[model samples]
Target: MISRASLRFSLGRFTTAEEIDAAAAKLVAVVTHLRQNAPAFEFD
Candidate 1:
């Protein structure tokens, strides 16, 4: 699970567009990995 702390850390520390993009990509990867590993789990 991606915690609010992790999201805040990523967004708070990144100031440039590239940094934000990288952070977003990393977040997407985390979500994808979780989805693939736990298909039956509900996100909401």
Candidate 2:
């Protein structure tokens, strides 16, 4: 079976859409790097 994992993020204050998108982009980049460097790691 395959299990999915995720991260929970909370901001102390309100944030703009651009800020949220930037954060998500960073997370995707990190995940992509891990997928490239680590054979067993994968994310969607």
Candidate 3:
């Protein structure tokens, strides 16, 4: 699981793009990272 700390860390360094795309991109990256590294973890 990608902890809230990691998400906060990623968002903390960014100052722009606070709209939908930015959020979508971040979520996608998080999901991708988790999926790749934690295949046995249930996302549902």
Candidate 4:
């Protein structure tokens, strides 16, 4: 049976382990990019 709830509310029913891993990898890449490109903060 197919579920009608959205991904965030699927109770992990419609989500796969590979999908979670891919999402985590994407998040890490985004954070890494931001860290590498963002400027350092200066305090007066």
Candidate 5:
């Protein structure tokens, strides 16, 4: 779902401050993109 919805954001390998910050930025970007572009996906 991450790959299908996000812009090639790779996760699960962050251990430094820069990497964590980048991950957070990527996450925000993904959520914003999905909110404005992708259809709403609700969990049941």
Candidate 6:
């Protein structure tokens, strides 16, 4: 059988544990990249 649903926000739907882990790794890399490229704040 197949499953499906509708939601307000669709981030994603992982079918297996491995898929979730892969997504987590990618998320970490994205966060690291964002932190590295984030704009610096300056106040006068």
Of the candidates shown, which would achieve the greatest lDDT relative to the real structure? 2
Off by over 4 Å in 6: 1-14, 42-44
**Selected candidate, larger TM-score, 3 vs 5:** 5
List per-prediction Cα lDDT, in the order shown.
0.67, 0.74, 0.64, 0.62, 0.67, 0.61
TM-score of every candidate: 0.53, 0.58, 0.46, 0.59, 0.53, 0.57
lDDT of 5 at 34: 66
Query: Which order, best to worst by TM-score?
Result: 4, 2, 6, 1, 5, 3
Off by over 4 Å in 2: 1-5, 11-13, 39-44
Which pairs of residues have clashing backbones in candidate 2?
none
Query: By the lDDT metric, which is better: model 4 or model 6?
Result: 4
lDDT of 2 by residue, 1-44 (tens): 33446888887667889898999999899987766776453332
User: What tens-digit string does per-residue lDDT give for candidate 6 at 1-44?
Assistant: 22223435245564677876887799779877866765555111
Assess candidate 3 and give its TM-score to the true structure. Answer: 0.46
lDDT of 6 at 28: 78
> How good is model 6 by TM-score?
0.57
Better of 2 and 5 by TM-score: 2
Q: Is candidate 3 or candidate 6 better by TM-score?
A: 6
Global local distance difference test of model 6? 0.61
Per model, state how many residue pairs clash: 0, 0, 0, 0, 0, 0
Worst lDDT run of 10 residues, candidate 4, spans: 2-11
| Candidate 3 lDDT, 1-44, residue by residue in tens | 43433544344454566665777898899888877786454443
Residue 7, candidate 1: Cα error in Å is 4.8
lDDT tens digits, residues 1-44, model 1?
Answer: 43333434634553888987897899899988876776453434
Give, for candidate 5, the lowest lDDT window spanning 10 residues. Answer: 1-10
